[model samples]
Target: MKKIILTLFTAIAVLALAACSSTSGASKDKEITLGATAGPYTDMVNKAIKPSLEKKGYKVKVVEFSDYIQPNLALSKGDLDANLFQHKVYMENFAKEKNLKLSEVVVVPTAPMGLYSNKFKSIEEIKEGSTLAIPNDPVNLARTLIMLKDAGLITIKEDTNQLTASEKDIKDNPKNLNFKPLEAAQLPRAVQSADVAAVPGNFALAAKMDLLDALQLENMPDTYRNRVVVNTKDLESAFAKDIKEVVESKEFEEVIDKEFKGFGKPEWMKK
Candidate 1:
């Protein structure tokens, strides 16, 4: 009888400890640290997402990264609960190359890349022999080149994978346009020198240029759209679910419409 009594007490203590452990994890999940690039993305989190999460009793902290690499590194190292600076292509590629487990929580409204020109008012106004500026990096170079194709400035080889296309893959160049590959950040300033500059949305906005002011904006794809990402291990966590719910909330869209005008939205947001 004494042995039975001792066993009962031990079981009760073990159950109590388990309850305490569960509560501690719940408490830890309530505090989330998210990383984003230092610009409109950071603003989006601060003004739109944070408030809704706060209402649900989550303490939100946003860390800004100037370059893209550090955010993912921090997230992989468990320094951040999630991050919001990269697209699907970048995230997947980075994860595979670095051997880190990461997943997207939700896709957000992303600013679209635009063709900006100081001289030309429209795509039709581009002249023969004009020196067009494009992104120097392969990924953006391909995307920017596609934007030019859509504008009727050039035609890419049908056999080519447009995702990795470059000037060498051009099947037709109606304008005899000279290609100048500049860094993405320098494209905004390239407008003053080059006939037209293909500037990514983030850099354009950071330079105080308006989105509607561009001659054309890319029909940004889901793969190219920015998303909220977290460690794959946390995919089933309550807080991760809450983050998705907060982003999907009507209030979040209201903030996006009011503050991030002219930005490209995901298809889910369209529906």
Candidate 2:
């Protein structure tokens, strides 16, 4: 009799454990956490994405990081369900270097990188040999050089891409421009001293710099569009699909227009 009682108790305990495990997994699936660097990314998620997800019966959490590294790391470590702050090229490079399984879930709008000035009012007004501050990092430096080329202040080699372009890649400098490379974070502050500073979109938005005041804005390529990134495994999941649909919806576009006036429409949306 005692043996029968023990067997029954063991069966009940096993069932209870399995039930608890199943419930935990189900709860996890119902909640989604997204990570992004503080600023535009956070603004988009909070002002737009969060409400969309919550309406679909998911509890959404937006985790804000102050720098580039932590968001990707957190997402990879399963601390975040997704992230929304990197270009595909940058994320691909980072994933390759870190051996992460990250992939782009959706392409968000291309925030046009712009040349902000404290001294010059227009690109033509920028005098010859004027020191222009650019992001020292390779990707942004290359992009800034391209924008300067388009502005006719300088010309980069046609063969150059953002990764390979440098001061030496300047095929011509009509303005006899003096280039100063500084940390991207410092470009906003540097504009006070430098004649013109090539600032990335997020940084400009964070600094509350007026986009209309920019001397020139880069025509963002499809490749430069910001993305919603996630674990490769999550790319096909229903939760991810819902999130993608929400961002690509008309409501989301309205938020984009209302929140980011000068930030141009995304190429994917052009379809």
Q: Scored by CA lDDT, what does every candidate get? A: 0.92, 0.86
TM-scores of the candidates in the order shown: 0.87, 0.85
Report clash pairs, candidate 1: none
lDDT tens digits by residue: candidate 1, 1-271: 9999999999999999999999888767699998999999999999998899889888889899999999999999999999998999999999999999999999999999999999999999889999989999998988888888888888988888867888789989988999898999999999999999999999999999999999999888788899999999999888889999999999999999999988999999999
lDDT of 2 by residue, 48-132 (tens): 7899888887888889999889999999999999998888788988999999988888888757889988787888898888998
How does residue 89 of candidate 1 score in lDDT?
A: 90
Model 1 alpha-carbon drift over 4 Å, by segment = 1-28
Name the runs in model 2 displaced over 4 angstroms. 1-28
RMSD over all Cα atoms, model 2: 6.0
